[model samples]
Target: MTSDAPAAADKRPRKADGDRLSKLARHKHIISQLTAAPTLRASELAAVLGVSGETIRRDLMELQEQKLINRTYGGASRPFALEPALTDRKAIMIAEREAMAAVIADLILPNEVLMLGAGATTFHIARRLASRAHDITVITHDYAIAAALAVNPSIRVLCCPGRYHPNEGYVFGTQTIANINSYEANRAIVSATGISARGANDADDEAGAIYGAMAKRAAEAILVADHSKFDQRALTVFAHWTDIDRLVTDRQPEGALATALRAAGTEIIVAQL
Candidate 1:
């Protein structure tokens, strides 16, 4: 179906995400230039990106599957709750994911305990976290996180090991839960599969078990999502809004999101993109 040559090239060029930003930078540029910014018609994105509208639609579909952005009648828009896979959304979206991750990383304290989820965004957050010299303990289901933080005895980067999930980039199972329960982290820097009006957040598989357990074990739950996870539901619900003490998302959430979370008494912390 695909060529190994291009697939192999994907890894070579993406050392630290150098070329990953190429496609996403275009997407962000278009979004920034457009007006009446609610619904982005697929045709417009295609013209801007110099691709066919169908190609843009395909991109939108990829983003929708990950719940990073919402698809409307004609196009997609940034929703308040989403965990998109920029890796699959073309190289450009990976840049956007990394940008989003940088914003999410602000929630980390110098020496706080962090719980990271598995995905494109959290992977970038892991990279940023690696540079900081904090007595930090990163609890994660992501195999990447452990490997990234390995050899760094200064920051206790612990992985919640289980059945490895290739897609979400983590391992999940009872062992993951057990490791998560063992840690009493001060804060959890995590992501979700999706969100809904009723305040249910879900993820793929029972993989959310580690996410839920970490949130419950932590003193604070700092949900790091872009403005895309809103109004969607995944296979499993990690927790509800009441448990989400502080939410760190890109840009100030508006529209129904402002109404929805306020009604639930959840504190919204927006990062300037």
Candidate 2:
């Protein structure tokens, strides 16, 4: 079966969605378009970018957060501030991530087998689960996640084999994907760099490949993403909305992304902060 947005290894592109550009690329395009006009409606950007109106709105929100654009009613205009690097938007939202982690930890049952992906938000989940969840076996490629879960004697931590990424502090490659595929988990809990109507995405290809493998190998897949990721697209579309059983987030997704998630039978769990 053809996946909605396959990993880079698969080399099979989803021809249906025209707005397949990464978030950073989209930001650049949006800025350029705004430069050409004083203001542009979300629908105009959506038509030009081949994405939904909701996605354009989300893009505008992200841009506004970065101080790159001024959001008007139904549209956006150029702002005076220069855009920052995409990866620079981090180290914040601690309270929100921890809240989502707490919610996920509550949902985790004893003796459950889980596949945990690497990311800041997922790391928070690991920390929360380590303190509360017992008798669960966690299989992960992230060294930090393994270390956090290892503190709980009741929980068993299994590490995957792969080349280590010094900066990201995780292991990812074909080996990691192969290792994840070797296990059958009760639930695969993964984090995303972005989540849109298309699916859960990651900025890194190797990490995304591992996430996709874990999702496919598990009985159920739970995606964890913060509000910042809402309506954002990334380099790798790891899992489609239909592949995800639940989405744990700090805020509820609105508009088109919300409708798409509902249509895909994805249950949204908003973490109370």
* Residue pairs in collision within model 1: 23-92, 24-92, 79-227, 81-228, 81-229, 81-230, 82-228, 82-229, 195-232
Number of backbone clashes in candidate 1: 9
lDDT tens per residue, model 2, 1-273:
778885665222223464377767778888877654557888877776677888888999999998778899989875532212323433678899899999999988988999999888888899999999999999998898899999999999999999998877789888888788778999999988788778988878888898988899889999998887876656778899999999999888987789889899999999999
Index of the highest-lDDT prediction = 2
lDDT of 1 by residue, 177-252 (tens): 8888887888776777665545546546575666677779889876766666655555667777777887766657
TM-score of 1: 0.63
- Model 1 root mean square deviation, Cα atoms: 15.1
Error of 1 at 228 (Å): 2.4
**Which residue runs of candidate 1 sit more than 4 Å off their true CA positions?**
1-86, 89-96, 151-153
Compared with the true structure, the alpha-carbon lDDT of candidate 1 equals 0.66
**What TM-score would candidate 2 get against the native?**
0.71
Would you estimate the TM-scores of all the predictions?
0.63, 0.71
Give the 10-residue window scoring lowest on summed lDDT in candidate 1: 6-15
